[model samples]
Target: YEEPLTGEQYRKLELGPAPIDFDNTIQSLETQSKIVKLEVHYHGHPQERFISLDEPDVSLLSARQLEVINETLERLSSMNATQISAFSHQDMPWKATEDKEIIDYELVFYRDPLTSVREYE
Candidate 1:
């Protein structure tokens, strides 16, 4: 089995506060009258977590981050895994683990998207 869960993971298992910059963007988007189409948050199993930051401002995804997120999404799009498993599931080419468990999903905004969210002002 994977290494035991770290104390930090056991501590809260909650979606920690987003990066300061991301917080600013979220605020800005909310202020601009942009409606949030989808706002979902989730936690991964032992070592991973993510957040789905979907909105009109989604265009703000950076190239690298976009690639990673989209790739996982693409794989998920092709499967019938649970909401949590689909996104954080790491099985590929060949199966690895038999136990299927939900993992934490943490969205990181430290990296800016290739495109910027259009400012409304």
Candidate 2:
């Protein structure tokens, strides 16, 4: 085997700060952010249910509609995940009804069948 290079040889091989590949990073983040895994559930109504919408379907939704879902999720995301189900009324706004407790947290946005306008609820 050949002997190792000297310190001076190694210094010569050192290059200045490398150029940042922002394009790759930005592209990666954009691609990853587009794929959101959402778990949906519904309650209060007599027939509780879960919704399963594919990625393509979700992408068809308007930005505003998605914002509402994101904002709602963000609010809950900041809370203690472990004690989420344990939260009482004191931790939230005044209850408008006794069925306010959330049994499902899946978020789905779609346009009204007739109006064709995006609705958050």
Top candidate (lDDT):
1
**Each model's number of backbone clashes?**
17, 2
lDDT of 2 by residue, 1-118 (tens): 0121111111110121112343454456456674333444434333322233334556655666566557656656765523443332222221221342321111112212321223
Q: Which stretches of model 2 miss by more than 4 angstroms?
A: 1-56, 81-83, 86-94, 99-121
Cα lDDT of all candidates, in order? 0.35, 0.34
In model 1, which runs have C-alpha deviations exceeding 4 angstroms? Answer: 1-25, 37-63, 77-82, 85-121
TM-score of every model?
A: 0.26, 0.27
TM-score for candidate 1, please give it: 0.26
